[model samples]
Target: MTFRLSVERLVRIFPAQGGAAEPTRAVDGVDFVATAGEITALVGPSGCGKSTLLAMIAGLEPCDSGAVRAGAVTVTALSAEKSALWRRAHVGFLFQDAGLVDRMRVIDNVMLPMIYRNAKPRDRRAAAIAALERLGLGNMIERRVDGLSGGERRRVGFARILADPRPLLICDEPSAGLDADNTEEIRKLLQIARADGACIILATHDPELVTVADKVLPMRRGQLVAPDLALRAGAQQAAAAS
Candidate 1:
């Protein structure tokens, strides 16, 4: 099934640590639509609320005020239990940290999402193997995740996305901190997902990946802005801090 994402007036505020500091408006009244069969790239400098916004859309973080709609479902309004269930059914998240179980075998880690969605064990195994093989990890399927390098772990995480093929794929810096080859590998994987008609939304600073996007949403200070304006805002903030 195909699903489009609609984000409306999204807001997330973090209170000041002490009485002295001002509150941080992580994502302030952001709105956009990410259509299925295309990729939406959120481009911005670090600490510009890209990750926070993705978290809210994924229902991994609560919104201060706003609504997230995926197809006909009100994502932000679902109960905690229901939200989790809904995510397992519809979302494929590729976290920046390469969220994987270090204690499990590589193949098992890739199979986790399929398990949550109750895929047949035999089919899940096949899909996991195919995904791993595609990412050049077929030989290490039985190896423990903790033994893998950072790049390997990240690739394993991508393999999970390949195995599940969820309608809504939310990726946070999917190609961050990788060599050219690995980054290219990730780009190919993302392209494959787009071709398969997943509504792909990713937070990235990778220009190569940006070139593949169907739409680019540039952000600054938690709000969408023109590309040039976002660059100017980031430069201005840096000069002020200096």
Candidate 2:
């Protein structure tokens, strides 16, 4: 199977307090592959480095060892400028916070990525509107982002990522501030993205998010374990006997 994203023996370390001790290993030799059209959920307790790994994958942070490959490109050796270009063209990031420009209109916030990429203004507006429609936020397009509720703000963020149309989407705690209804809506949006051939990596502490994942990676003390494998195998055995 072809992987849209792969991390091979990746390691990331953060400087210790006072800058005199050994750096702390935030991600300890992690390896994983996200196949195209699949959702991979990274779940862990707070402070366990799930976000750290996601940032590395997004090229927002550098790794201390090993390689990160997005499709055919190796990100580890790319210059900062090249990495930024790669991210602009191939990656969409959704932060734990809505990360909207509060002063901007919802539609404008959703169009920001395309604008940064220098898309034609008319084309960008149309695409942003379409994305907002897809997220069921078409009616909120003209409203200021600061005026929207948490769920609405999150939808705007999702619309932004959808408008970007990147093949790789990395989201940190997408369902963080959502209610049950909003969370389900976001999950459906993620499923749609996966079906459209985007590889999605979502970092969250929510078990609800794990239920929809193709693979669930649990992190503890900066190490990941594949808990979903055992769970699925047991389910398969039970089904065989039934």
**Considering every candidate listed, which one attains the maximal lDDT?**
1
* Pairs with backbone N, CA or C atoms under 3 Å apart (clashes), candidate 1: none
Sliding window of 10 residues with minimal summed lDDT for model 2: 225-234
Give candidate 2 regions above 4 Å deviation.
1-3, 18-22, 228-242
| Residue-by-residue lDDT tens digits, candidate 2, 101-148 | 999999999999999899999999999999899878888899999989
TM-scores, one per candidate: 0.94, 0.86
> In terms of TM-score, how similar is model 2 to the real structure?
0.86
Candidate 1 lDDT tens digits, 1-242 = 45779999999999987774889999998999988889999999888899999999999999989999999999999999999999999899999899999899999999999888889999999999999999899999999999988888888998998898989999999887778888888888888888988999999999988988999999987998987887787799899999
lDDT of each: 0.91, 0.86
Q: What is the lDDT of candidate 2?
A: 0.86
